[model samples]
Target: MFWFVDGEKSEYSGGRTAVEIKSWCTEMTGPAVKEISSRKLAEEQAGTKPICVYEGPEASTDFEEIAARKRTEFTFYHVAVDTEKPTVSVQHKSEEPVACDDLTFDGLKKCLDDNTLPLFGVLDGETYEKYMTSGKGLVWACLEMESSDDLEKVADEYRPLIKEVAEEFKDQFAFLYIDTIQFKRFLEGVLGVTELPTLAVNKKAGDKLKYLYTGEMTAPKVDEFLKNVLDGSIEPTLKSEPVPSSQDEPIHVVVGSTLVEDVFQPDKDVLFEVYAPWCGHCKRLAPEYEKVAKKVAEAGLDDMVVLSKMDGTANDSPVESISWEGFPSLFYVKAGETEPIKYDGPREAEGMWEWIEEHHSNSEGLKERVAAGKAVHEEEDSEADKGEEL
Candidate 1:
């Protein structure tokens, strides 16, 4: 049963004030508890709250029974309240109990909200958002949902397989079934699921990689697929645009297919930008970015340094560490380094040039190339000085 204690009151009834306790539960706490319960069970739309509030001396035995059941079996959320010690604890079936910070109404609500979801469930828009950001990998079974009967048949076929895998790998992944009709756009556009009754896994919080199962749908096959995904045996499917035929602009155009080839060259330091065409900020930065590119070219540093931009909306970076929260996000990658350092300074051309110069001077590859007489920047500067002297 859900627990909600009024923060204003200091003490709880211990069989002496049963009448007062019942009145408080019915009138004051009823509405708020019902609201929290309803929101949590919105997927079922079960209006009634499945809670039984107990008070006084006999409650101790009930709490013990609930705790024992939680350790031995798979059950829903069970909350234990110690009014005298004035502590709150929440526990789900067979899982460790978490102590709530306070006895306030909001505290109880948060505890239940965080632990109420089952290990295996249907994926709706709301639950999908929750699970994707939960820092866990997701395993999805795409089922045809054109008709109620079809949905039921497909669900029945895949439910056992999903449940089995969920039990075995609950720590690593969240198992869910999604309606093909409901998430058609996502399936086709992101995961490239053309057929129904397909299995897919997204390593969202880890490598941000995705994999699809190709063979028959069975518990063992699905288990093997998940194992391979964890062990990195399978290649990930990437969302990439076609590589451009030519890059003649000062800012070399980068696509996902050519990310490693162009930006991650071991002998060249790179200033990379991820921008969306529709973004006003990106549009505003275009001229200044071109100016920076031109400065690099004129200085004869084009071979040692590259100015590149990628349309973040159309392509995904093959480098898993590369990501952007907004358009026109900039990063600097030194030669022979895969890690990208974020550029968060000013947006003007002069400021960008300063940042580039600072990193370039510190580049080990540039030093090595200059020592080997492969880089001409030093020679260009010396010749310019001589010309000035003459």
Candidate 2:
């Protein structure tokens, strides 16, 4: 169950938007629980009504059991709906331009302290793992160096520009700096950083990890890249290891982790199987999945619909997406469509073809599938809202 306060229209009109409660979850679930609890209490005492306890589909059944152990275990949020406009006091404060903080060891450490956005700082191994490795949505890490005064000057020169961009994307993305001198191995080994002032955008689409941007960083160039990433115009670099090649099989091997290259860009309907090695169900479904792949190729849907598979066990970052429902999961990615539709029909090759023929060919059905895929993400966000309490 997730708890948050939301504004609605008189119970007559509908309203749905999750806000401020996001910050509360971090404080309540984090290390400083006592401090956060006291603060939360103070806020409530100030007459801020707490409302809405939403129960999601994936919420734990053992809510009472968990609540027994931890008093903060939120079962439901009080629903706060306000239709009337209330008068409020206006307090004026000095307005100033947002500033960017320079990257340092201490500043980088502090990045992990909370979920604050536009947190631009140097990223070391510690910061990288906490913010980048398992990072959700768009996380930007711009690499810099202190080896040369000129290089430092270049970084300093772009600080304001970065700050401007960060401020605009503060709500959706996280921007950080990485000093190559401090974390040389991580820069080279993990991120494959070669150029100075390379602005790299780390993103995960579905279960696939991809870098949206990694190149030269000028104000205009970086701005264009940022725009492209936001609008889904830029191609994403995969974060997973290379897919093992298979010569004899009819199945097309997904060479890298880039969903854009293998899944989205291609003009074909994709039947993707996300399976774990250890799962018995996955093992049982492998041969059938292969059959579906071979049959699809034979049916001449190979160009229109390609069959693909990814080892969920082998790849972590890509599969860590909110799109990953479970192991042995199958999805239908229609050609030219950005969203992949979950395959809930029979697993047999014939059933697969029928499903592809019926929904993939029908434009309206495809739209519903897209809408359904979007709903899944919304659910995931709600679950994330409840995660802190658990």
* Model 2 Cα lDDT, one tens digit per residue, 1-390: 333222211111112334445555554445321122222232343211111121222222232222222223211221222424211111101112121132232432233222222235444433444354334454445445557334345555666777677666655566665555756665454454556556656554122444545555556777777778778776555445665654467766553364445766446677777777788988877777788777655544455667777665454333332246478887777777777777898777667666766776454654465466578879999999899779
Compared with the true structure, the alpha-carbon lDDT of candidate 1 equals 0.64
- State candidate 1's TM-score: 0.65
Ten contiguous residues with the weakest lDDT in model 2 = 86-95
Using alpha carbons, what is the TM-score of model 2? 0.39
Q: What lDDT does each candidate get?
A: 0.64, 0.50
Q: Which segments of model 2 are wrong by more than 4 Å?
A: 1-137, 142-172, 177-198, 202-224, 227-233, 238-247, 256-270, 276-281, 291-306, 311-326, 333-340, 346-390
